[model samples]
Target: MKRLLAMGCGLLVLGWANGMAAAPSPDTASVDKAIVHLAPTKGNKVQGTVRFETVKGGVKVTADLTGLTPGKHGFHVHEKGDCSAPDGSSAGGHFNPTGQAHGGPDATARHEGDLGNLVADASGAAHYERVDQQLTLQGPNSILGRSVVVHAKADDFKTQPSGASGDRVALGKIEPEK
Candidate 1:
């Protein structure tokens, strides 16, 4: 009976440990889709990794960009997550969370898809970290089904919200990992 009791206690501890590790973080959830890949654009020079994290608040994007012009550049979550096309035209317009027109990410009245500029270093590298309270990784308005884009120009932050990045230099799609 003593040995049996010990074994049962060990099993319970093991189960509890497993449950803790498998449990999602308080402000985060199991990210259904996360794909970080590379692509070339016709305009700006960009190369880096993009990660999509599903948090309790919403979906988060962490971008590490290099080979840029060392300054402010347009960064936005596009409507489509398809970067299959060479020119990256496959990625649709900016993400519109409120179903509004395309605007800056910080714009008071703009699309939920708009995200502000990404600042690069003298070496032309930029690191972006953003958590969207309105986007998701699995819902209809989910950014997981969208694309992350880097532009060659800086978003004035006032001009219609989307700093009018001349063209798409780099692109990546957000998809769930297996």
Candidate 2:
């Protein structure tokens, strides 16, 4: 009888743990489809896609950008997730959660929206993957309604923290595909 009781307790605990692992947290959601594409600019044309999923603490943003000039360009999630306007002007400033000054994505005290730079190869393509726990896709400060921007130059990673990435070349809105 004692042995059976112990076995049952162990099984119950194991089952509970498994159930928790299989369940999705209320704050998390899967980004079924995030379509990022290139918009025609007066000079260059850049395009890409960012796929993400809500993890326990934050989100994982995976991206693939191509057709940019060969160099390091600033990449960021802007304040307004709108890419409707030409030249991708619809997307506003960087995502600034802490109300900090505009800076680099990896800066210690920069804007919450700054995401640093993307390095393109000689072939003019940039590929990257990153995880962010500070952004929400549906809540008050969700990144879902934001846009991603690719700059014309490398983000210096210093100097106001925005890396001085030049003109916004490529722009895309973070939206679920219909």
Candidate 3:
């Protein structure tokens, strides 16, 4: 009887260990869509909405912004979700989980947040659409809790750690679609 009880206990322990090991890791199953509603920073009038949807190749990002200059502006997914500061400094630097250099979205070596630039039209409005392969809504590199920031100047793309983008003009936090 004693030997049988010991064997049963060992089997239970092995089963529990196996179950733990087989548990699934973090994924995007619950995050099919996300959105960020941008607001103007200090002394800026930029406002917009950015939507992220899971597509076949990657996340499809769509943005519509107004009140910007008729030119290109730097855009990125910042590391922090705080946009409380008037200057949008509350949102930290770009979200670079892989510690890559600052480059355009198509570059082979670039930060996951290096989304390049947004071009405003003559009416001070901009519409952007792209399929990003590096960004993810789920997993360890997820951008769900991060923030989006628009800069006053265009991203130079050649800068070392970050493109010499100017001051942040707009800020928003990424959240699951309601």
Q: RMSD to native for every prediction? A: 12.9, 12.3, 7.3
- What are the per-residue Cα lDDT tens digits for candidate 1 across 1-178? 9999999999999998865543223222455547667577765567898787677676677888888887898887776777877788898777765667556665567766677788999998888887766656654355655678878888766665465786778988766666
Off by over 4 Å in 3: 1-28
Estimate every model's Cα lDDT from 0 to 1: 0.72, 0.69, 0.89
Candidate numbers sorted by lDDT from highest down: 3, 1, 2
Better of 1 and 3 by TM-score: 3
Candidate 3: give the clashing pairs. none
Q: Between prediction 2 and prediction 3, which has the larger lDDT?
A: 3
Best by TM-score: 3
Superposed by TM-score, candidate 1 places the C-alpha of residue 149 at a distance from the truth, in angstroms, of 1.1
Relative to the true structure, candidate 3 has a C-alpha RMSD (angstroms) of 7.3
Give TM per candidate: 0.72, 0.72, 0.84
